[model samples]
Target: MSDIEMIRAARARIAGNLRRTPLLSAPALDAIAGRRVLLKAECLQVTGSFKARGGWSAVSAIAPEVRARGVIAFSSGNHAQGVAHAAREHGVPAVILMPQDAPKAKIDGTRALGAEVVLFDRERDDRDAMGAALAEERGLTLIKPFDDALVVAGQGTLGLELAEQANEHGVTSAEVLVCCGGGGLSSGVALALEAEAPGLRVRTCEPEGFDDVARSLAAGEIRRNDRLSGSICDAIVTPQPGNLTFPILRRLCGPGLAVSEDEVLRAMALAFRHLRVVIEPGGAVSLAAALFRPEALTGETAIAVATGGNVDAALYARALSTLE
Candidate 1:
């Protein structure tokens, strides 16, 4: 549903609202990965994640009269803060349903952004049903985290930037690794690259046990994760790939990659050391794959998108301690 045209329109609509995060590279990272590696430091993006792009794209596209009624969304954390910030900017009320065990930093961040935060059990509660009911009751528009076309289109804007940046660096062909949850960012990036930089392919990256996207891509159909709440990569632990995003991923992305929790922590530590960018566990998976799973990659270069930086202080300290 999200094509290059819609993605370009999203970029235009969200112009001046979102930051075009930097594409960074360090010789240290390149040496570790055994290839030229570019890190799209989206962790430095507004709201501390790339989700802001999609949130603004979706919220801004709503009819002005309807947008005034407000909007609702369900996220583990990153998307919650994104939608919350966007709604606050538009001067509309926002209600976000977040998993009870999401990082405390994310919960507080969402509330600080002027959105009412509602907690739900990730395993025992159905967020979809609850979000729908709340939307109907409050006359709010439902802004789906990934399944919406506008959200995908909005996220695709990141790909457009990446494509141009890669070209500027003389990277004509490389594997663009994306930290994928329900595949919103990956699918959107895949779609954008397919048109603007066909030589740059997207590869979905996930934590080992919560690799539904990887397994689904291997099977050529959707596959559900057996458990959703155990991974420390909470920002990206979704039960399944989104219906709208999976097909795009299957068609445009390469084989999905899974990295261990230990690998992710190490990647976070290395990112902080070499790139000076703090990355949450979920956001570090792509870098983990790029650094540790080099056997699966092709070409002489790789691009990894560091998706978020909203980690709890304790967790971040623990990740940093790994280097000692």
Candidate 2:
């Protein structure tokens, strides 16, 4: 199917199955910008993140027999929850592979969604390798968290909604800022935004560690940096950019910007106190870019994708305390 067609099908597939979340506007958020800022609060989405949009869309698109064998997923955080939550709805068994260092909350939450969880030592052994081995051994269909076309299209549905919602809410066009890891969400968001609201500029926000896109865009070549990319904002901590996703984003996105961990935490706090949104470090990243790098979006009304809200309980407490 064509890319637009895939997004259309995903929208239909997920309709009534997911929340028709708001394209929320706030005078407070507007105050941040001389113009205005609209927050697509995907943080409030199912499993507390936008990953659900792609996860449900991709898994459901699979053949019945394929889904019957259940699914295997590799993630450090939010996508794991997305996969597990979607698998639960289909009565499919799921095996999730995660870095042993992944937050305890995500590991537990994945299991809470009724998916079996396994841990790999990301420091010594490769998580992807472990996941591939497990998938082959268990007869599970590996659900690539970002690389899959179905997942990308599924993620694109958000852009479609943003476009439709913007027209309805008096936001005809705006700068779209999305957090990035492997670029699944950013790629889909950019494609959907352009198709839905042509001429939209999409900006990708990344942490310093996995900031490959920013480097590559600057150098005009792929560069890998597996170093620690800020804190446990598991949403955008991809070790490297995806081969399929990078080209699309390079063509679509205006430019990628990186934010510090402090900026991310502070942005997370702002969303909690002002926007009444609870986002993990990764999910709040796009907003972090906005808060710290407004020059990148100078002279435009902006829409930031508040991607996920799956902060560990302890981290949530710490954020709340910092805000207070």
Candidate 3:
């Protein structure tokens, strides 16, 4: 089977594990974007993020012997908790490698799910390298956060839910918005929508500091950002777009837009006030594009992926304190 086929198969195998999260129109955002807006509330998903979809998909795909060895993963936060939660359900142990600078709430949340957490430095070493080494040393099945095909397909299931939700709610031809990191969630989602709901235009939103996906698409090659600065959207600190994911995004998604730290923080507060959902800065960036970059998406219905609810309470409070 092709990569897309494999992804589809993975989705089929893991269909029983995920939630069909709500996709609802935000009347408030309609007034802001000047277009009807919908939010896919994946933050309310099982692991408090959309990462659970990919985690469970990859976990359940393993053969009995492979799964018997247990699993290990590396994530900034969301995927760590995702692996922990999925492994718990599958009766296996999960180990997660996270950057030392990751939010305390994310560290605590991953640990709370009973996964062993190991902290490292993004400046010194990559999580993929560290995770691969650990997985090899311990003979554990490794699940990548955003680069694996199974993981990508699993993340695509969110699109399945969105399409179903859109049909159910009588909203079609809307834009499906996702916050871009390594491109796992959006790639999978775009593919799913392409296959299932061709009318939907899948789009990506990212922090200005970590705009590799958008930049790479423009340059037609992978471009790395040597310095990442001023992003409240910490979950989206990817230095470069994944090779497999970049091509997918290039072909499957429409023009990806970026926003500032101020924009993301403001959007985060807006979601909290209007949707009554806790969206981390990264997740809120998609909505930020919808709100602040409305001219880029005029006349089209928009949907923002509320990718995760996991926020650093201290950070959130700080952001809120500065609100005007």
Top-scoring candidate (lDDT): 1
Predicted structure 3: lDDT: 0.83
| Over 4 Å off, model 1 | none
Q: Write the per-residue lDDT of candidate 3 for residues 1-324, one digit (tens) a residue.
A: 115576677668776677778875667878988888888888899878999888888898888788977899888899999888889889988899988888899999999989989998877777677778888988799888788888898888888778888888777687777998889988888888887788888788888868888888888888887765346787777778888788888887888799988888887787777778888888888988988898888456888898988898887876566556
Estimate every model's Cα lDDT from 0 to 1. Answer: 0.94, 0.81, 0.83
Clashing residue pairs in all predictions, respectively, total 0, 2, 0
**Rank list by lDDT:** 1, 3, 2
lDDT of 2 by residue, 1-324 (tens): 227778889999999878867877667756765567788899888888888888899889889988998898888878888999889999999998887778887788899999888887766777777877888887788878788888888888888888888888777667888988888888888888877798567888887667888887777667787674346676677766788788878788887899887778888888888888788888888887876687778656788888888888888777667666
- Model 1 gets an lDDT of 0.94
What is the clash tally of candidate 1?
0
The estimated TM-scores of all candidates read 0.99, 0.95, 0.94
- Superposed on all Cα atoms, the candidates' RMSDs to the truth, in angstroms, are 0.7, 1.7, 1.9
> lDDT by residue for model 1 over 146-220, one digit each (tens)?
999999999999999999999999999999999999999999899999999999999999999899999999999
lDDT of 3 at 84: 89
